[model samples]
Target chain A: MENQQQDAEPEDNSWLQSRVAELENNWRTAMADLDNLRKRTVRDTVQVRQQERKRAAKELLTVLDNLDLAIGHAEADPKTIVAGVEAVRAQADLAMSNLGFPRYGDDQGEPFDPQLHEAVSVVPAVGVKPGTVVQVVRPGYGDAENQLRPAAVVVAKAD
Target chain B: MENQQQDAEPEDNSWLQSRVAELENNWRTAMADLDNLRKRTVRDTVQVRQQERKRAAKELLTVLDNLDLAIGHAEADPKTIVAGVEAVRAQADLAMSNLGFPRYGDDQGEPFDPQLHEAVSVVPAVGVKPGTVVQVVRPGYGDAENQLRPAAVVVAKAD
Candidate 1:
């Protein structure tokens, strides 16, 4: 039994050793490829996301500017034009939201938050408490951290 | 002077030989890295773009569904309601465009090419020749071989 075992051991060892060495080489090559791919993916994702955001932002700017112009043409029909402008705003918001940036207007009556809100005006509030948001000057899109734009706001303060 | 030159020549040749070998190795490694990175970048760019487009498309689906609803509720002063609806439509178009799927809606009378236009219905026309696009039903997105959708259109037929 000892002779048989000894005879079998080296016979199996060489073949297995060669197989293991071949596998190790293949594995290392694959791992290097995977590592390179991962690094490249990170860089590409950043570039694509930045490009999408810029394109969306530029489009939004055009629509918003057009809405502003429509608002000026109020003499034709105030209610209709205003409704149209609101509709355009909603569409813009939907586009941003669709791009993983849901619309948010956290500036109305909420406590002052620098992270989410941008203070455009600070005025003493008669009814509202100090440091509370009095109004949202411009609505914002998306969440606090991933926000496309911060809400331009009016914060209340003590006289 | 001749002896000094002879000594310097050997030293210079040895240094140059070693430097050239080192530079060749470095250049080869860098070139391999660049090629690998380029290939990986292309794969990653496609993946990232598709991921972002899917995200945008998912978001747009809800907005598009909502716009369909809004279209039903569009009796709130025709001009205003229309303005709102148009804005929403424009926004959706812009969103698709931003995602590398630019809207394609060439007006009536353009010659129908099978590549860009998909004929849904055929109708007789007075002035328009057969195979001319009569109307576009749903706009196409993306361009040529990379098209996301083909234009659902009606082609004019011989009267």
Candidate 2:
């Protein structure tokens, strides 16, 4: 904030009376540029997002298509079905991670955190301390600053 | 530009002799705003691209992980092995498609289009024209516009 204010210094206002017109013109021009930039920024942001969405969508869609195909074939053979399914699942996860959604909240022994975990149920743990995550039903994603989603989990019941 | 020049006529600058000093201040303020917006736009563009790359990477990673898992389990059953591999492939395709890239350029009946189809081979055909696409060995993802990759194909030869 302070830096921005300092930059607003006009070079020569002491003789503004002589160049009142000029000063006004300069100021208005700058203002108009700023205004135009504001509008452009908004437009650009939308465009950028749309481009990203399309690109991301295409990549992820490919994964989904492959997964669907694999699922179809899985019914034919049961021996290595899980393995194939797991591979497809991995692809899906990778696609998501590429989108800046690195997976988190999968720590089995980590303590329960409300910020990272969504409590699905509270179960009595025989050995684990209360308030600890007893189970993670679904994993969460991202970090504190750019959170994608929370991990669904079960916390230990309090004594 | 023309409209802005006329705007000055609405206000009289004759009285600004004493307040002429403020002209410099106003100009400065406007200039500062303009500068700030320019910087913001540049920053925004970069951030957008970064986000896009991250998203793309994540989606692909998931598929890779699944593939890894599937291959490990392939030994369990020969019959189900292909199913697992196929599912992984489908998942990849879906992911890409979701990102705005779908499998394309595999049509054998469609005439050869330089814009969409690349001619890798030209076989002499009785009815087919020289430029007609006869076979597409490998499918291309996306179109030439924002396409991920061009389809490697074979086209009919002109007699």
| Best model per DockQ | 2
lDDT of 1 by residue, A1-106 (tens): 2223233333344443444445555555655776777776787688787566445434444444455455556456655564655565566566666566676775
Over 4 Å off in model 2, which ranges? A1-18, A39-43, A50-95, B1-14, B18-22, B39-98
* DockQ values of all predictions: 0.06, 0.28
Worst 10 residues of 1 chain A by lDDT: A1-10
- By TM-score, the best candidate is 2
Q: How many backbone clashes does every candidate have?
A: 1, 66
lDDT of 2: 0.67
Per-residue lDDT, model 1, residue B116, is 85
- Candidate 2 lDDT tens digits, A1-159: 222222221322223333776787888888888888899889988788768767676656566556555666666765545665666566666666767677776666678777788888988877988788877776666766666668889888867
Docking class of 1: incorrect
Candidate 2 residue B132 Cα shift, in angstroms, is 1.2
Interface RMSD of each: 15.4, 9.6
